[model samples]
Target: MQPDNSQPKTKPKIASSTTDPVDFDHAIGPDTSTPDGRREIRRATAASAMGNMTEWFDYGVYAVAVTYISFHFFPTEGGTLMALGTFALSFLVRPIGGLVWGPLGDKLGRKHVLALTIVMMSLSTFLIGVLPTFEQVGILAPVLLVLLRMVQGFSTGGEYGGAATFMAEYAPDKKRGFLGSFLEFGTLGGFALGTAVMLLLQVGLGDEAMMAWGWRVPFMLALPMGLIGWYLRNKLEDTPVFQELEERGEVQQHSSLASLIRGYWRPMLVMSGLVIALNVVNYTLLSYMPTYLEGQLELDPQASLMVILIGEVAMMAVIPFAGSLSDKVGRKPLWIGSLVGLFVLALPLFWLMGRSFPLAILGFAILGLLYIPQLATITATFPAMFPSHVRFAGFAVTYNVATAIFGGTAAIVNEGVIDASGFLLFPAVYMMAACLIGLLATRYMPETAGASLRGTAVPDAHDTGILADADA
Candidate 1:
């Protein structure tokens, strides 16, 4: 089926009771026709991206600093595995966070929930920098770390879905793919920043100082980032789509679990499957690659960091282009291509990564580039899977549940399987399996690239003609 790139010709009736006027001529939301309107959209994008960056910065720091974290928090015998386990443990609470925060976001507006979640997430990350080591507090240190990680995870449950929803709602429909890509751009930016900081400190401070105190510096930086995100978010009003919902009194009073399940089980399941592919590749490459390279491939820590940094920066550079391409093409095509590419190349790349340092860089770069299409289109694709009223709830609940189960546990799973069976290529095989699920999900996903997300009905439901088949 051909994609519709045109905006809807007729405007929805703007409620006369609204305090703020909405320009409905544009069809998506907000008036992009005026300079001021464009500026507001930019502001909204920045607000969304900043919060997203702050959330991911913590994950990136934690992923790269596993060695230090394990050293400071766990027993020496199997400290790395324990640290990874703690990382996985944080994700266990993500669904709980989603359950609480998602409905609140849908009911309360995006900005307030985002402001609270950012502060909570950032504070939790910052406190980790100050926590006493296992040497200082013994078992209590790991316990404390676990507590803080859970808080971060909980807050993030709301942060990501809300941020993406905000960004997607504010963006023009035709440019949604391009603009939404910036959110993931923030994601890669956060990972790159954290990795860069660790690399710089490692080179400047050396091993002794790094292990002693330098590691804390990256965690400490999170507070300021969070504060900046909060400030930006507060500067803007809620998203135009959300504002319209409020004005129309069409907003859901409560996005209850039973309601969401009964209404949106299909999208939730499809999103879950897509996320399995998205985040398994995500955590495996961005989060676990350093550990895998250093421990499995025997690359030095510095080299491992460099490889990931280069690959991430490359992905960041291409993300905008890929997102723009999705606008011209469609989200499903890119996703299908990426899933297929990864499935086909996962094992060979893993094999090549084991051969040498230069080959490792080549292998990782290829995998990262292949993964970019999926990453770049996340904010564009996922949020539009449901209508605006339940967008936040649908995205948060589905995404967090999937991520908690599969995405967050990726590192630990790979490590545990490798250790138990002595199979070094298990991560690659795991990614391939995830890609298969993504392919099936993509088959049933509605093509929403240029669809309006304004009303109560599912966006592009009639255009794609897949939901009925999916239900069947």
Candidate 2:
């Protein structure tokens, strides 16, 4: 079939709520203007954000405490590197988790999967706190630690995709970007909170006490956090979009895998490609910055945690502004600007980070600012790439696969690159490369700001059912 010339290139028209047979926003709770609506929105937002908080809190503690974990979990020689390696190990199974949980999310409902993931993550994280040390358990200690991390990775694979989908579907279209920012806020908030807790503990307890038992306290905190997230999620209704699909009898009976494979290859590739930059920046700054500061630059461990804590707090403040701005200008503009900014500034930031405390904080803060556009808008952007039926699976599989390969291994890869080449700032080079890939991917995506969650179907020759379901 020849391509139709009737469709608009830049802005694709999608089915609006008024014209659609079903109201996607119904049963999502009270109106946005009413008291009940405001309370429901707050509860829904917390439900979504807390899951992100739980996942990142564990990650933040692990990354910040890698040095201590290294001494206790692995051999003395290269123990830190091994600890970092263990950190990366958990991500290896994320794709598998995505495959299992993503389709289940699409098949069942986003709320149930989210509740399950929190439980899995919380149990694994809490168990790590009580695990025997290398001195006490011999080789079994590291083995058990790796096993627990694998479980964490598996659960997290499903957590983020579902959270983003649920939040976007529940939000008002005009304010999706603004409200979506809360999810990322929870992300940075969790990391900042975890880092702050560790920093205070380190300051008060001293290294010896922290290494002995203080670290376990933070890990143990995951139990209560996860329980709160689970309760919030259980109290909420399923997303308006998913509910609408079900009501309209448009919910797919086939597996999300089949639907994705049959029609969503391009979007899957594009989403994965964009994630390259987003996650490399995420893991690099959020996950690896402390390691780089303390291990490579030889900054004080407590000071390094403090720098990251401050940077994350700053990033959290700016994320909603960036997300709200994207709603006005377009998701593509912010993404393009940030990719270019990171490409240009990655090297300079690293250079400044090596200088002194003030410059290091300044450098990290700048990098975090540049990174905000991507992190802030991702929840608003990626879920819009696919139709409601396969949104969870499509986002989960592609995001986790790319994250597993690039994001999870960022620290290890940077360490190896610098080690082999004798260049300290190779991470800057890596970040730039990832940004370039993301830039290319973003250009191909339709401008989706304020677009319907169920996209506008173009009566064109190139219409693939699933892709058209996502609209432009």
- Which prediction has the highest lDDT against the true structure? 1
Stretches of candidate 2 above 4 Å error?
1-30, 256-259, 455-472
Q: What is the C-alpha local distance difference test score of each model?
A: 0.89, 0.84
Using Cα atoms with residue i matched to residue i, what is each candidate's TM-score against the true structure?
0.93, 0.91
Residues 64-162 of candidate 2: C-alpha lDDT, one tens digit per residue:
889778888986887877898999989998988999889888878899999999999998999999999999989999999999999999998999999
Residue range with the least summed lDDT across 10 consecutive positions in model 2: 458-467
Q: Name the 10 consecutive residues with the lowest summed lDDT in model 1.
A: 9-18
| Per-residue error (Å), model 2, residue 29 | 5.9
Supply the global lDDT for candidate 2.
0.84
Q: On residues 1-472, what C-alpha lDDT tens digit does candidate 1 reach at each position?
A: 2322253333233222323433334454557889888898888888888889988999999999999998898868989999999989889899999999999998999989999999999999999999999899899999999999999989989999999999999898778889999999999999999999999999999999999999999999999999999999999988878988887887778558998998788989999999999999999999999999999888999999999999999999999999998877778889999999999999999999999999999999999999999999999899998888889999999999999999999999999999999999999999999999999999888788776677676777344333333334
**Best-fitting candidate, measured by TM-score?**
1
Clashes of each: 0, 2
